[model samples]
Each structure stands twice: as structure tokens, then as C-alpha cells.
Target: MNILLDAAQTAARLPWAPLVDEIEALLTDPTVQVPPRTVLPMAAGAFLFAMPGCDARTAMTKLITFTPANVGTATPTIQGDVAVFDVASGARTLILDGPTVTGRRTAAVSALGARWLAPNLAGPMLIVGAGVQGQAHVEVFAAALGVKQFRIASRRRASAEALAAHARRLGLRAEVVDDADAALADCPLVATCTPASAVVLRGQPRDDAFIAAVGAFTPQMVELAPELCRAIAAQGRIVVDSRDAGHEAGDLLQAGLDVDAMPALADIVAGQPKARDARGPVLFKSCGWAGWDLAAARLAAKSRPTG
Candidate 1:
């Protein structure tokens, strides 16, 4: 029998700390298989994405869609579902809500990476973009890193205000700022979670800052400027969640980086010798991967108190 989890149920089950640990474990696990994502363009400017992965005990695939036209409607800009299967029997086992799974898992991975790479995180965290991803990052980082202040910036002030309000409810100090650069100044941590085609954050962050660029999935989309990438790359570091990052992450591609040249997040997590050092401004670019969805879904199955 297949189990189905809605948005609320999934949220209740998969909290930040455990979810972040699960993602951390999955990235370092040698038995896991995470293939590059396949992007298929649909009619009417929509995009269909397929990400698949497997572990020793289970496998899963997530199907999601991005429709630009759906922005103002009741439907979300991102819509999709994930299918989980038993690795041994090859039978379908669960179906998880894609949006919730994607949002939380993505944020969890960002938080996990920050936890390890930027161990001394402090001061205000600048969150660029005030959508679902923006909110998720705020919640996860506040809980995991104990960040006391958040400066939420978006092209839309109303959106930023709403996210700041949500952040306040979480017991963190948050404020809406019209200028993204102003928010970046003196901020120790920054998460760019927008889907903008052009760069959203300008100028250089503090030398000790840690950046998580979670938006700009396509080759034409970018959230960080090429100069920022160059600066971070000069340290011989610009971490990414997957090997396919160069191909899928526009922020790196635009900076003239070959996807294959970048180091995988797993290697850094495993404590490889040449991995990124603790000093300098560290940038973690996430282009999305299937293994993350698989890990989150498996955790959801185990975390459901009533199930």
C-alpha cells in the first residue's frame, strides 16, 4: 500500500534539525545513487523536471513543474509530487507532496551545509527573495544556526513584509528592507532564494560571510554576480550540492565555470583533504538533486507520529 502525505502532515513530521541531519547523512553515504536531473520544456513556457535517486533501502523520483504564468493565480509557481519505492522489492511505497518536500528539504540542505562550512555563523542573515523558499530558509537557519536577526528583501515590499512577519512569529527579529545590498552589508550569512533571471544581490559580502545560492536553476537565471563567484572561486572553493551543478546552476555557468570542475558537496561533507577551507567567504550553490528528496521522504515516513 502506498502512503500519501499532504503539506501540513509533511511539515509536522519533517522538522528542521532531523531533516538537516538526514540530508547530511544522505550526501555522505557511499551507497546512495544520485543522477543528474532531467529538464524537459513544456508547452506554454512551462518546465517539467525529473530527479531520481536511490539508497540501499529505498529509491524515489520527484516530478515538478514551473509555470511562469501561475505566479498570480491560486496555483503555485512550482507544483509536483514525489514517488518513493522499496529498493529490494521495487514496489511503490509512498507519495509525498512535492512542494513541501522540495521547500523543506532544500532549506535543510542549505542549513546543513552552512552548519558544517560556516561553523562560526553569527550576526544578521540577509534573505534575498520573499517567497516560499525565503520563508523556509529563515525558519531553518534561525533554528539551526540561532541567527538572531534577518533582513528580508524582495522586489515586492508586500512579499518581503509578509515573510518578515512570519519570521517574527518564529521568535526571530526580522525586518523588510527595500535594498538587497543594504541588507548584505555586515551580514555574516546570506541566502539568495529568488528565481530571478538577473542577479539579485550586488557588491561583495563580508570576507567571513557564508552564502547559499538556492535560486537560479536554469542556465539563463542568476542570483549572484559573476564577480562574487570569481572572488569565492579564487579561494579554490565554491561548494555545490551535486556534480551536475555547473550544468544546472546558472550562477556558476555565467561565471565561466565548467560544471565538472566544481567539487561536489558530498566530498566536502566527507572531509576530503582538498575540500573548502573554513576561512574566506564560502558560497554553496544548490542546483537540486534527487537524493535529497529521497532522504526527506524516507524521514517523513519514519517521523509521522500517527501513522
Candidate 2:
């Protein structure tokens, strides 16, 4: 059965605010064989996938976030769908609204990252890029961490300020800044929210700066320095949402990061390994796992009154 969910209705009933605990508990006791995202280039755009074996349910999705060149027209920033299956029966169960699910689940994943790794995460959070992912980051982090100060930076000052203004309207202390450096300096939990294939952020943190680089999916297209692999190699443990992403994610391989050292988010949450090294400066390279999306969505479904 292919049951489709209304984006608006599903989003409203997202249960995103309450899904954090389930996501955390999942990190502690995982039931899926999560694979890092895969990519297949299409003529118009490309498809990225994160397959979770059994995360409350068996789910796999191909998130097709398009190239910015296409955005010149009215092409959506991200558009895709998720196909969920039954573990025991191997029957197709649900086909979710991919584009909406991607934004919400990805945001939840980053929020979970902030909840577990960001140490002493007080004050100003700087989010680069004011796209769907960028906006989602702000929503998740604000809900996860009781942050007081927030700043949004985009290539366009108007858009950045708009996001800031939105946050403030939501009762969050925030503002939009034209300078990226100032945002990084003010906020300890700095995020790389852009997907552009270049080094973003004014610079990495001075010390113990927690970064969740949600941008930069391919090695050719990276948001931070290729030397970041070396930076984390030296200073802190470079943890990933999933090690499988290391192979699929260009940022890590391009940075000359070794997969052997990369730890899974589950391990960090499970106490299999410590969140950060004694030195500090922890890094989380997120390719946006399917497991997280499925995890968040599955839990959300449980909250609804099923027929």
C-alpha cells in the first residue's frame, strides 16, 4: 500500500517537538543498518539517499535537492520522496512527502546533534544560509538548546535579516548580520548551513567550537577547508552521523579524513565512545541520514490516531 501524506497536514502534526526523545533513545539502542547517503546525478538534478535498515520501521529515501543553477527559475530547493517498508513482510507501507520530510527530519537530526555534542552551548548561534535547511536548523536548535542569542547570515542581507526577524517573532532572541565573522565570533555553536561547494564560515572556532556542517555534500563541493580533516584529526574527534557517509560524503574524504577514526552518532549517544576528546573542538559531518528522517517520521506517525 502506498499511502501518501499531505505535506501541510503532516508538517502541522509533525510531532517534531516531541520526537527528540525517540531520536535520542534510538541513538542509544539502534535497530537499523544505516548506510551513508548515495548520489546519482540526473540530467536536471541529483538524488541523495540515506537508508535505514530498521529504525522503528524500515525506511529509505532519495532526497533530491537540486543544483542552484536550476534555482534561477522556480525549481524547488529540495524535492524527493521516502518509501517505507515492512521488515517482516517486506511489503511497502508508506510513501511520505519527501521534500517536507527532508527539511523537518534533517532539522531534527541537527538538533539531535546539538543536544548530544555541543558543550557549554550557551548564547549566540550563528546559522549560515537562509534556505530551507538553514531555517530548519534554527527551529531545531532553538527547540533543542534553550539558546538566548541567535544570528542568521546569508549572501543576501535581506534574507538573513528576514530569518532573524522570524526567529525574534517566535520569541527567540535573534538578529540578522551582514558579516559572517561577527556571527561566528558571537555564537559558539556555529553552523555551516549553505550547500554551496566552497569553504563557508569566517573561520573555524578558536577553541572547543562545536560545528555541525550540514552543507557541503560532495568532496568537489565542500563548505569547509579540506584541511578540516586534519584539524579535527589533531584537535578533536571528528564524529559522523554515520560512518557509511564518510565514503559517500565528499567533505571527509576530500579532507583526507580517515574513516577508521570516524565514530558514528549512535556510538556517541550510546557511550561506546566519548562525545569529544580531552582536548575539545568536536566536529559532526552530517550528510543527513535516512535513518534520522525515518526515525523522526516514524515516531511522528505513532502520535497520530491511526485508522
Candidate 3:
């Protein structure tokens, strides 16, 4: 029987540690195959994304919609489902909520990057944007890295406060900051999760900071200032979650940085010596990848009972 998992059910199966481990394992597995996702423009500044991937044992596809216009509406900005299949027979095995998988898996990738690139996993991580991605990052960082303090910033103060309250319920210290740029000065770990066409975070990050820029996935969308991106490329190192980031990572592209030269998360996961060294602020650009969804599917399948 094919199982259907809603947002909450899907989230319960993908705990931070195991999901991160699955993603890391897939990074080095030669049998895993993930092609670049397809994004088509929709009406009113929205997008339809089809991401597919397969490994030796499992195959999955995530079909989701991105609607930036729904930011304040009752509807979520992202909606869809991830369909998992048995690789051998090509039989559908499970259906998981798309947004939950996207949010959690994306945050897991950032947490994995932090494991290798962060200067320190100390308190007071700064998260720019208080949307779903922002809250997911807080949950992953707090659970996986044991980060206890967070500074939340967003275009909407109420949203930031709400996220802060959520963090407090998780027994973490969280505060709403009016200025994300100012918060950058003290935070050794930072994540920008806003879906902004213009730069949302400006200025140079702390020298020892690890910044995960995960908001912008297209060449036109940008969250970090181009100048700051250039500064990081010049002084520190910029790493990407996938090579596809060369075309999708807007922060690096807008800054005219050669993303082709940046090391990928897979390279880091493989323990490449050059990718391990962090001389200055390390910026991890995550543009989303199908392999991550595949990893989530693998984990979700493991938790379910076999027929």
C-alpha cells in the first residue's frame, strides 16, 4: 500500500541528524543521480519546479510551486508533494508533503555545511528572514549543532517575533533584531532565508563567520548585497551546495563572482583538503538540489513499516 504523509508526518520522519547523515551519505555515493531541476515561470511572478533524483535503492520526484505573492496570504508560498518510488519496480511507495521536505532538507544541508565550515558553533546565530525557511534553520541549528541563541530579522517584525517565540518553546534563546546587518557583526553563524529580489543583508560578515545564503535560487533573486558577496570571494571563500548553483546562485552571480570556481558541498562532504580550510568568512550558497529530496525520501522510507 502506498503511504501518504502530510506536512507534520513528513517532518516527524526527517529528524535533523538522520536527514543530514542521509544527505552526506548520498553526497559520496556514486550510484546517486540528480539532474538539474526544471523551473518554469508562472502567472504573477510564480514558478513551477520539477526536481527528480534517484539512487541505487530509491527514486523520487518533488513537484512544487513557488508563489512569492503569497507571502502575507493564508496560503503558503510553497506547495506540492514529493512522490517516492521503489527503484526496482518503479512502484510508488510513499507520498510526502513537498514544502516540509524542502524546508527541512534545505536546512539540513546548511547544518551539514556548518559542521565543516563554521568557525564555531557558539551561541547567537543570526537568521535573516522569518518565514518557513528561517524557522526551519533555527530548528536544525538548534537540534543538530546545539546552537542555543538566535537573532531573528525580517521585513516584518511580527513574523520575526513569532519565530522567536517558536525558538523559545524549543528551549533556545531567540531575539528579534531590527537590523540584520548589525547583527552580522556579532554572529559567527548567519543564514539569509528571505525571498528578496533586492539585497536584504549588507556589509561584511565577521571574519570567522559561516554564512549560508539559501534564499535566492534564481539569477535574478538576491538576498545578500553584491558588494558583500564580492568581499567574501576576495577575502574568504565561497562554497556552494551544488554545481548547479553556478547558474542559480544569484548572490554570487550578481556579484560577478565566478561560481564555477567555488567548491561544492559534495566536495566538502568528501573531505577534500582544500575545501576544509576556512581562512576567513565562509559563505555557503544553497540553490536547492534534487539529491536532497532523494535523501529525504530515503529517510522517510526507512521509518515506515513494510507491507
Candidate 4:
């Protein structure tokens, strides 16, 4: 029987520690194969994404929709499912909630990047944008990194307060801030989770800060200003999550940074030597990849009920 997991069930299976470990393992696994995702345009600036990946044991594909216009609406902006298949027998096995998988995996990717790239986590982390990704980042970082303090900022004050409340409920200290740029000075960690076309973060980061830019994936969208990206590149290092980031990382692309020349997360995980000043500011630009979804599917598959 094919197993179908809803949002809560899917999330329950993908615990933070195991999910992060799975992603880290696959980062260096040569048998893993993930083709470039295909993006089809829909009316009113929506997008349909088809992402597929496979390993020696399992094959999975995540089909999802991205509708930017649904940001404030009751309907979520992302919706779909991840279908898992048995590679050897070519039998469908499991179906997991798509948005839940995407949220957890994307946040885990950032947490993994921080584990390798972040200089220190002594100070509070600053989160710009209080949407789904923002909340996920807070939860994952706190659970995975033992982070205890957070600062939330968003264009909508109510949203920021809500995220702050959510963080407090997790037994972490959280404060709502008015300016993300100003908060950059005190935070050793920063994450920009907005989907804005223009820049949402400006100014320079702290000398030893690790910033995860996860909002803008397409070449046309950006969260960090071009100048800020260049500043980080010149001062420290900018690591991308995958090779697809060469074209999908808008923050780096808009800044005219040579993404192909930068070190990928896989290289770092493989013990490659640093290419830039390791003690200075660091930025991790994440463009979503199917490999991450595959990792999630692998985890969910382990929880499948047997006859």
C-alpha cells in the first residue's frame, strides 16, 4: 500500500537532527543524482516547479506551485506533494506533504551551512521577514544549533510580533526590531526570508557574522542589495548551497558576483580548503534543490508502516 502523509505527519517524521544529518551525508554521496529543476510560468506571477532526484535506493520528485500573490491570503503560497518510488522495483511507495518538506529541508540546509561556515553563534540571530521560511529558520536553528536568542523584523509589524511570540513559546528570547539593517551589527547570525524583488537588507554585516540569504531564488528576485553582497564577497566568503545557484541566486547574480567561482556547500562538506578569509563575514546563499527533497523523502520512507 502506498503511504500518504499529511503536513503534521510529514513534519513529525523529519526531525531536525536526523534531517540535517541526512542532508550532510548526501552532500558528499556520489551516487546521488539531482537534475536541474524546471520552472514553468503561470499567470499573475505564479510558478510551477518540477524537481526530481534519485539515489541508489530511492527516486523522488517534488511538484509544487509558488504564488507570490498569496503572501497575505489565508491560502499558502506553496502547495504540492513529494512522491517517493522504489528505484529497484519502480513501485510508488510514499507521498509526503510538499510544503512541509520544502520548509523543513530548506531550513535544514541553512542550519547545515551555519554548522560549517558560521564563525560563532554567541549573539542573537536576526531574522528578516516573518513568513513561513522565517519561522522555520528560527525553529531549525534553535533545535539544531542550540541558539537561544532571536530578533525578528518584517515589513508587517504584526507578523514580526507573531514570530517573536512564536519564538518565545519555544523558550527562546525574541524581540521585534524595526530595522533589519541596524540589527545586523549585533547579530552574529542573520537570515533573510522575504520574497521581495528589490533589496530587503542593506548595510554591512558584523565582522564575524554568517548571513543566510534564502528569500530570492530566481534571477529577478533579491533580498540583499547588490552592494551589500559585493561587500560580503570582498570581506569574507559567499557559499552557495548547490551548483544551480549559479543562475538561481539572484542576490549574488545581481551583485555581479561570480557564483561559479565561489565554493559550494558540497566542497566545504568534502573538506576543501577555504578560498577566502574565513574569519571575516560569511554569507550562504540558498537556492532550493531537489536533492534536499530527496533527503526528506528518504527520512519519511523510513517511517512507512509495513504489513
In candidate 2, what are the lDDT values of residues 1-307, reduced to their tens digit?
Answer: 2267656645653555666666776666546656655566656445444444465455555455555565425777676666666666777766677777777777777777767777657867888888777787788777767776777888878778788888888789887877776566567787777866566653556466677887766556677677765676687667787765666556677777776467777777877454544466767788766667767556645556233
Which is superior by TM-score, 2 or 3?
A: 3
Which candidate would rank higher by lDDT, 1 or 2? 1
Model 1, poorest ten-residue lDDT window? Answer: 271-280
Q: Enumerate residue pairs that collide in model 1.
A: 246-259
Model 4 per-residue lDDT tens digits across residues 1-307: 5388888888988988788999999888889999999999999999999999999999999999999999899999999999999999999998899999999999999999998889987759999999999999999999999999999999999999999999999999999999899999899999999976678898889989999999889998999999999999998889999999999999999899999998889989898554333769999999999999999988888854221
> Model 3: per-residue lDDT, tens digit, 57-133?
89999999999999888999999999999999999999999999999999999999999888777958999999889
Q: Where does model 2 exceed 4 Å of error? A: 35-38, 48-52, 55-65, 86-93, 272-278, 305-307
Task: For candidate 2, list the clashing residue pairs, or say none.
Answer: 219-250
- Candidate 1: tens digits of C-alpha lDDT, residues 1-307: 4378778776877888889889888876788887788899989777999989888888899999988778647989888898888889998878888999999999998988787776347868899999899999999998876888999899888999999999888889999888887766668789999876678986777777788999877787799998888878886367888877767889888889766877677878777553335667888899788888988977876775444
TM-scores of all predicted structures: 0.93, 0.86, 0.96, 0.96
Off by over 4 Å in 4: 272-277, 304-307
Q: Candidate 3 local accuracy as lDDT?
A: 0.91
Model 4, residue 53: displacement in angstroms? Answer: 0.5
Local lDDT at 46 for model 1: 79
The full ranking of all candidates by lDDT, starting with the best, is 4, 3, 1, 2
The total number of steric clashes, by the backbone 3 Å criterion, in model 4 comes to 0
